[model samples]
Target chain A: MSELATLTLAEAREKLRAGETTARALTEACLAAIEGAAALNAFVRVDPERALAAADAADARRAAGEDGPVLGLPIGIKDVYCTEGLGTQSASRILEDFVPPYESTVTMKLREAGAVALGKCNMDEFAMGSTTEHSVYGATVSPWRRAGDTAPLTAGGSSGGSAAAVAADLCLAALGSDTGGSIRQPAAFTGTVGIKPTYGRCSRWGMVAYASSLDQAGPMTKTVRDAAILLGAIAGHDPKDSTSAPREVPDFEAALKGDMRGRRIGLPKEYGADLPDEIAALWDRGAEMLRDAGAEVVEISLPNTPHALPAYYIIATAEASSNLARYDGVRYGRRASLGQGDGIVDLYEKSRAEGFGREVQRRVMIGAYVLSAGYYDAYYLRAQKIRSLVRADFEAAFGQVDAILTPVTPSAAFPLGEMEGDPVKMYLQDVFSVTLNLAGLPGISVPVGLSGEGLPLGLQLIGRPWGEAELLDTAFALERAAGFGHKPESWWR
Target chain B: MSIDTDTARRIAGLARIRVEEADLPGLAGELSQILGWVEQLQAVDVSGVEPMTSVTPMALPMREDTVTSGDMRDKVMANAPDAREGFFAVPKVVE
Candidate 1:
């Protein structure tokens, strides 16, 4: 790896501002690192020409004495964002080679702030599976491994590639979308910092929809400060997204004071499942650290937490079924060849069957069943009502405490194919991360420590609705207390 | 709540995805297991709660009835699988 690739996003920004480094040099270092680490399968596409052009433009701006948060930084984008003239496939065959004519609002904002796009990272097909194995491009391997163990472990999905790239120092930071732990879970497994802001905090225009109500885009970076910086640049309301909130976007980096005096942190009793000993110990250690930071720690209850997974699955799949109905092989994407005398119905069926993967097909089928006339009340409506209960549980808890803390995942990263055969088991992986989405709350995952086998583990902090500033401040305190600075050796290279 | 082969086939048709006859049995098994797992939601009492259509409680914003941008037929058809004479080409429906 090049020496330039080792700098964090914040560090690189300082160097760029001080005239110690150029954006072209930094971009070239990341491109070299990406080329060397091909075995990790982190990036789906890397457009070096476009990246260099943007970096040169940033260098020109810097020479002209102009500066911004990400003035000369090269960052990776998840394939789910619609970048103009770039293939935004979402790692699915259905949208293969389908370049967009417009840019997503989030990416456009990043560009306007002078951030250069490195390339598109891989993800699960339609962001459906917990493991990125469901992608047409295949699974992304985590950079960390057990001591003396050659087995390739999974970088958790559906933002697995984003996490892997950051962990391996391919980019300063990357964009990741969460719809039931897609960002936090992967960040936890890869020992990176990921933040999923409140649901409507960032505009969703031009982003490929998975579960429209639950899906959200966030930042994945190597440190809490970098996550805060990226979040500041890519947040706010847009007229294009009707659901976006009309609220002022605060300077998130300024809120990372790292002081927790007089704050109230809650430990939800219901989150204590039959966790592994390492995870349980880590959770307790996290609470103790907060208490030592002069914050009052209290035990709270969210009684409806157990039903979040089932309800999340129902609502996500149902919405996914509705959102993905646009691809009919008529307007865009891959089309199945028709036999002689085939009708329109045959065209739709053959095209979808040929385009969608197995997991996607299963989700669509389940969605169709639940939303059908006979079973809508029993399944879909019931799930929505349960969703209300989940949100109510969080609202009730937040009234007593300022923020809630829990484990991001039940355990650390497991080997690839461990839970692939059982879809329900994979769904259970998002148990602790889904309720935040259901409540439209902001949450951040910070790497706290490592498991017994030497894999990374993370603790999740969930804040009240539209309370990201406070949430990031509290997370900064925890990050400073944890003081975790270990990096995995570059074995993938 | 078990999804038999018949129900699976019907669901596939509704979803407009062509499932092979040989894959129906496997698909039925997987769907049945998923439905069985989600049945645990029935144990919760959501009696008085209204079904949440969105996470935020705000109403959808309205827009003025005016054109924001001009037409770009070439840009709209840039990704079409088959386009001819500024229209998407599909199988003829009129006999």
Candidate 2:
């Protein structure tokens, strides 16, 4: 194994600061990793020249003794984020060559803090599906899978690329956006730790909007501490985004406490109910682990859990329909030819018909129907009502418990084509999630143990509004209990 | 209500997506199954429940009624299929 490949962001930064390793060496190691994993389809594009140039600048800054946690570290950014001079396609054919003039708030912060941008990672187009299968580019396979498994297992979507790249050690850590379970699900599937911080905790100013109400960006990393360090580099108030929270971002790396002595963790009754037997066993074992680590664990019910899926689909698809309306071919992406004398309406219809994918079209249609004049009362309004009930359920549960524990997905990663024809079944994979999106709460997925088939399972920790520290403590405590230290085989390396 | 092929085609058209006639039957079946899953929501009695937009119960923030936005005209129009004199030029709709 390569020396720089094994170093965490913390270790690599320390070495860079202490003159032990040059930023060029670290960037070169990451570039080699990316080149080695070319067959895995982790990155959409890699500009070696630009990345090295940035690294050289970081080395100069360090020589001047200026320091930041992420300075000189190479990070993979999801293509969904707008990075200047790099294509920000969101893995959709629509924006295949669209490069934004300005950088995303998160990207701006990363650059200012001195993290080298390795390249853009692939994702489900517009952050649509559960598996990365929906990407126009191609599916990103799980690095955790063994050889001869021709049918690659899912690296969870829409941030599956980000998680897979980090798991394969192609980049120190990657930025991922979670609209519903995008980040956490992919993190669980790949055996990496992912945090979807509290809504508005990180600015979504330039992340291509999936569902404006629910989309949040966070870090995917090999360990909890690495994720914290990356989060510290990115989290802060941005004047560009009105929704960006103004709360003080505590030093996330320093906040990692293995001691959970007085914390009360809730075991949501709904998560374990009717789940696959193997997944239930994992959830039970996770609760036991937390209990053994000197934490109080108790059963709590979020009775409105069953209603969360329906409410979320309605709210998310509704917002997505409105947000995606800007994607007519005349703006950005592919366009269908229109007759010279054709009117604006005809132009719009033709452009949209050619630009969007089938799944995106399905969502827009469903959303439009729900928000249409006659059905708004019956569909959209009713969904909003159920949304409040779902939020109230969390409030009630949090009154009794600090953080809720559950399985990230009802099951482990399934094969690529398993849920192809059934979009609803794929959406059901988000059941254990989505409610967090509706409530705009922070959630993290940490690897627990293996299932009966030896696939990895993850325990999800959800916190109250702005409750990331408590969530991380619970995750660290459980990570110790799980002892899931295995890495993916060399095919990925 | 079970959706048929006709309904599926109409919905696809309304959503501005082009679908072949042969694809309608499969879509109708898949969409109907989804509706069946969503129908589970109707069974719960939310007769007096207030619809929720966000998790917190706070009202919308009332900000000063001042106009503020970026002037990235060149950037915003960078991807336009056709542009003329710093504006998006579309085919004339009205005579």
Candidate 3:
């Protein structure tokens, strides 16, 4: 493996500034690493030409005295973000050959910050399932596997590809879109750091909408500082996104004071009730690590926690059904061939049926059912109220705690086909991380330890809305105390 | 409430995705199980809780009603599956 490919985004910026390495050298090293690790299937497409062109441009600008934060950084973009002239399918066959002429705000911001685009990462079709198995491109297996086990483990989803890419060193960092547990779960599974920023922190303009309200983009990287640096560059208010927060973007990297003295952290009693003993033990040890750093850890009550997943499915799927209605096959993407007497409605029906995969179709159906007449109040409205309670529960908890720490997932990465029997079985994986999206809070998953089987497990620290700076700081302290330094053996290649 | 194939067909129709008659039963079965799991939310006491319209508590910022962008007829129609006379072509709705 190229050592250049393994450098964190923060470390690479220093090397580039010292004239010790060129952007072209870093980009080419990542390209070489990507080519050598095809079995990972982390990237759906690798644009070496585009990557080289961008890197060369970055190098030129640096020589001209421009000092942007993310300048010369090589990153993988999730397929969910619309990268102009590059295929942005969101991993659905319906958009198999679809290429947007416009760019999503997040990617445009990354490019404007001088980041080089290595390629598009794979994800679940429409960001629906917990496993990436629902993708048209197939499952993105995690880089980590149980000791002595040869089975291919899932890297979690719908941000599975970005997590796998960062974990396997395919890029310095990658963009991940989180609606439910997409970013954090995958990061936990891969032992990389992923954060889902407070809702409205990142503009959704030009990104493929999953659940309009719940979906937000954040960074998945090898370390917390890299996450802070990359997140600062991409988040801000956008006139195009009406729901985007009209507030000041902070210097997130500077918040890494790394001192946990007197900071209050909450361990929600609702979490880990049903988790495996090892996961709960890892979480307990994480609390101990934080306690060792002088932070006051307390048992807090997020009383509405158990209802979060049910409410999330109802609300997110409802939004997804409405958002996905835009893909009617009249423009930009695959249009199923029709026969005589077929009208536009049939065209819409057939194209959608043929385009959406199993999980997506199921969610859309459930979404439509909930939103349909007679059930709207029985399902969607009640779920929205439950969502309000989920938020209120957090509001009450935040009254006493600066941040709440919980396990990122119910368990570590499971083997493929383990949850295929029932779709709800898969939905249960998001139980630990879904409530934050409902409450519109910022949450970061930092890998603190490994499961006994040897897969990485992460702890989540959720902060108040727009409180990512403090959240990242607490996570930084926890990370320092744990000093987790395990890497999966090179087995995929 | 368990959904029957008839209700599943109705949902697929509302969703605008075609489902075969044979597939409706399986789809209904899966949806029933999911909804059965989700039914737990119905027991929550939300009488005083309002429906959360947005995640963040920010007031929806309003902008003046004006066309900030336009005049890209070619760009607008570029991704159309079929275009006729600079417009998206579709099956005749009038019949």
Candidate 4:
């Protein structure tokens, strides 16, 4: 990788501002890196013509004295974000032939901000699985290999491709969405920073839906400062997305000074269950780091943590089934050919069955069952009640502390197919990360240390609803304290 | 409680996904397992709690009852599997 590809978005922003480098040069370097790193399976598509055109336009805008946060920056878009002419596949075969005539609001904002897109990154099929293995394009291999083993690990899903692209220096930053732990867990698996802002912070317009209530688009970047900058460019109210919060976009980049003075950080004991010794030790050190930075570290309790995963699955899959009901055969996407005596109903059934993958089908069926007539009161309603209790847990915790600190995942990235047989084991991957989504809050995973096997590990810092400014500020302090500089060696071609 | 293959077929019919007879058993087992796991929520005392309708606290935003977008006949029909006269074409439903 070129030195240009290794620069953080913040550093590149400075160089671009000072006329030290051009967006075309950075875009070319990143495109070269992406072309060479096809073995990583990070990017699903790379449009050099479009990327270069945009880069040149960014340069022209720079020359014309227009200034923006992401001006002249090169980044990757997740395949779920519709990019007009650029295909938005969402790593599902059902939508293999589907390309939107319109652009997703998030990508439109990025383009309007003068950022150039390298390509669309890969993801799990319909953002349903924990590993990118469920993707129609195939699983994205993590650039980071274990110290003694060369076996390729997973870059956690459904934003696995975005995480791998950023980690491998294929792009300076990338857009990733987190419904459960999609963004943060992958960022932990790779040494990157990912933040799922408050639920309604970023617009969901034009982006493919997965669990409408829990899904959020966030930035996967090399540092918290870059996340702040990238998020600032994309976060705001979109009249198009009525669920989007009607709030002013704060200057998040300006809020980061690496100062933790007069802040209270909470460490929930419930997250300590099933945690490995190395991760536990690192969690302790993370708290110490915050304490050393002049923050009051408190042992807080989020009592309903154990029920979070089960309840999250119940609610998420239910919403998923409803949100995914649009892919009927007649409108768009894959359409199964009708047989003799078949009608529109058969078209709907056959098209959906053939289009959706096993995991997606599994979740959709589970969702259908839960939301069905007989199961509604027993499952979906109960889960929603549990959702309220989960939010109550966080509300009470926030009353005692400004931000809560916890490990992003119970285990680091494992090898692909290690837990492939059972779906429940894979669901456990989001055990610690789902409560925030259920409660509609902001959370960031900053790489704090490496595991005993030399894989990168991250700690999550969750904030109250719409409290991303303080959350990013605390993450900056943690990033400064950790000084995580480990990068994956170029083992994959 | 485990789901039988018959119930699985019924659920598949409800979801509008054609599951082969052979796949029904597997789908039923998976659903039963997931539902069994999520059954833990039943133990919680949610007797008086109102089920959460939205994750965030915002009321549903409403706009004037006016057509905000339309008139792109070609663009609208662009991604359809089968279309004629700018309308989606499907197999006949009448008997």
Candidate 5:
């Protein structure tokens, strides 16, 4: 699979700055295409001797010339970040064998931008499901199928193994998170290019919290200039995550130049309601490919986009029942053993009823019955006042639009146990991505085509709150007018 | 607004979680169909709105009171499922 495992993390950082390759040969061709795709379970952990000892210390810091911006490349990360000694399990059987003795400030800014992690991918256990079938290291699949149907499908979820390890190339860009619409619905079910950004643009300390005010972390590439060079190597302002955004990380790959002319965009009209007519003709062919690239699309109105998926499932399960009330097994994770005369509240209810799972115990019992106490103002203060009217419908459509488009998922990848015994039909497949994580903003998605069972279908956009370099320069002019350049043929290799 | 199997065993004992008796009548029919589809947020009228705890309007920052890093009792008892001398053992809360 070594077509240098299909380049593009900005063409393997321009063939490792033209020495024509060798961060241990593009991390041993992405660890031999993540050891032959292992039927797209898409990496849980692969290390390869600490990713070829961080690709031989990024080829000795590119032969002592020391250049960065993802130097030796490789990348994959997202078992919800934390990486130090690795095992970081947000794919949770209550952090099965946890590990992490520190690191994750976006994998220490992708190991100080020399990259090469090549491990920990699978997600949706604590990031909680749209379909990595609420993983404990299980469902990833979607390398896209259909014509001559082989079944598998769903690779969209809490960053479905970083969108099936960057759509099966297994890794050239991965890191995910997006509290809801988990990394732009698995980069629109694996066609790739994800994003999220904006909610304090990046740094959520060590990442794993399901909804600390709607998690952020981004990039799941394949293109849009390798998600603006991995969002300028994992965004800025950290001082250890004081809600990150102290701002100033731009030069997102020098704000891609696909110039959207007189920009505007918008579209909304409550996401053209009950969609499906091939996602309302692919949201009118992504508003006629952003009005044939010169921009000005219009027809806006977020009309509280139908209360952004029940106020993002009540403020992301009331901040995931107060950030999973610190997994009570004591100092770390998985515990539940005592029994014969238990106490400490029956050892915090049998180690959280044997380390949570059924959709994180139905979102920590609907976030402890909407922050209990006579249903705290009738269900988490009316879902935080419908999350302030879904952030005043995207702050009044970013004051008549500078970016908004839509449709990231009204339908596409559905198959693996077809929305398994309905968890609100898998939370209505994140209704067009939980309103930009209930208006924290910046969106992305991209892919833009395919389906009549062929599959891909993306679009999204959104921007404005810290507008990720005008949302990757209008998703690089809708990825150069949806010239999508389809891929998915290796049927999971 | 339906959820009964004794309010799904009192919201799984106020979310400490451990619900059984046949998983509280199938977790009270899936929390009464996710609270009857989040009772469409009681049909909208958020009377004097305000409740958005945070979407990034910042504020909490502070910092300066010194002691920036912790000592790291063995990397905080390396993922302790039991630990002991340096705490985190759990269970016998004053037996």
Candidate 6:
């Protein structure tokens, strides 16, 4: 393996600042890596010229004495985030030409720090499915597979491309949205570290809305520190995003201590109750590792977990239905234009019918029905009430724990097309991660080990709202203890 | 939770998406399965619980009603598919 390919963003930043490496060189290295990993389908679009241009400017800025942690680092942006000049299609054909006039708040901040955009990574259409199979571009496969390994493992969805790109070293780190488990599950599947920060910790102004209530953008990187560095660069209050929390953002790097000598971590019983032996074993081993790091581990229960999946589907699909309504042919997105000289209503009907995919159209119909006349009180309104109960479940757990540990997924990455026909089966992928979104809590997925079939497994860490610093620190400790940061087989020397 | 073809067609109309009558059966089956999944929420008892409108329990920051939007009629219409003299043009609603 190329040792340089495994370098973290922190190391890349230090190297770039010390004059040992130029931003252009780093960007070139990432682009070269992207070229090598192209067969893995890790990128939806790659902007080498733009990336090098930004890098050259960063080099000039540094010569003139300007600074930032991400100065000149190459980053892959998930297509969901609107890049000012880049076509920000959420991996859906509907918004294929819908370029935004303004940059997403997070992407703008990345540029402010002198980070170069490699290009947009692919994702599930509108971030709806757990597998990127829903993407108009096609599914992103795992980079860790070998010959005769026909398991066809998922890289995980929505953020699968970001995870695969990071794992394959196509970019130093990438941005991914976590509407459900988009970020964390893909991270687990691809053997990378991904974080979904507390809702509002990062502004969502230009991110194409999925489940607006649950959507959050965070970093997918090779290590925990990269996640923190990226988090500090992109997180803070934004005037454009009313939902952006106005609280002062903490210096995450300053809090990344190797020692967690006297902290409390909770292990939720509900997260462990129905064990698929292997997954349960992963959790037990994770708790032991945390305990070994001098952290206190206590078993706690979030009793409402059984209801979490149900409540999440209700709240998420409900919000998804509304957020995705903007894609009607009238405004932005592909116009269906059936019946050439038809009236407005006919144009809308035709355009929507042709423009949206099956899953998106289904959600819209469901959302409109649920929010319609008589059913509102029974469905959408009732789901919102249950959403509160779910939030309370996390609030009650956080009172006793500084951070919570659990498995990132119920099972290791299954074969691609395995869950394609079954949406319900695929949704179970978010069972461990969605509750954190419901409570607006920050969470990260760290690779723990490989499954018997040689696929990556991950452990999840949940933190209090705005408590990402402590969360990353604990992950850094366990990351060191776990010693599982091996590169995927495809990248072998 | 099994949506009939008629229910599916009604939903498609409500959502303003056109679907052929023949496609309604497949859509109805899919919608029915999804609704079945959503019905799982009914099992949770949230009788006294309040609906969560936003995270952090913050109220909408209210302000006196004022029209502060920019006067960009022409600029706003620039992206419209069909616009005429600073106005978005659509087929006449009623003749």
RMSD for all candidates, in order, please.
0.9, 1.9, 1.0, 1.0, 20.4, 2.2
Give the Å error, residue A45, model 1.
0.5
Candidate 1: tens digits of C-alpha lDDT, residues A246-274: 99998889999988898999999999978
lDDT of 3 by residue, A164-268 (tens): 999999899999999998999999999999999999999999889999989999999999999999999999999999988888999999999888899999998
Candidate 1: which pairs clash?
none
Tell me candidate 4's fraction of native contacts, as a decimal between 0 and 1: 0.87
How many steric clashes between backbone atoms does each model show?
0, 3, 0, 0, 0, 1
DockQ versus reference, model 5: 0.32
Candidate structures ordered by DockQ, highest first: 4, 3, 1, 6, 2, 5
Error of 5 at A274 (Å): 25
lDDT by residue for model 2 (A384-474), tens: 8888888888989999988899999988888888888778888988998899998889999999887666667798999989888778877
Off by over 4 Å in 4: none
lDDT, residue A218, candidate 4: 97
Worst 10-residue lDDT window for candidate 4 chain A reads: A324-333
lDDT for A89 in candidate 3 is: 90
Residue A115: error of model 6 in Å? 0.4
DockQ of all models, two decimals each: 0.85, 0.57, 0.85, 0.86, 0.32, 0.61
DockQ of 2: 0.57
Q: Tell me the tens digit of each residue's lDDT in model 6 across A203-239.
A: 9999999888889999999888888899999999886
Identify the superior model by DockQ, candidate 4 or candidate 5: 4
Candidate 2 stretches with Cα past 4 Å from truth are A146-150, A339-341, B57-71
Winner by TM-score between candidate 6 and candidate 5: 6
Which of the CAPRI classes, incorrect, acceptable, medium or high, describes model 2?
Answer: medium
Error of 4 at A13 (Å): 1.2
Fnat across every predicted model, in order: 0.85, 0.55, 0.90, 0.87, 0.86, 0.62
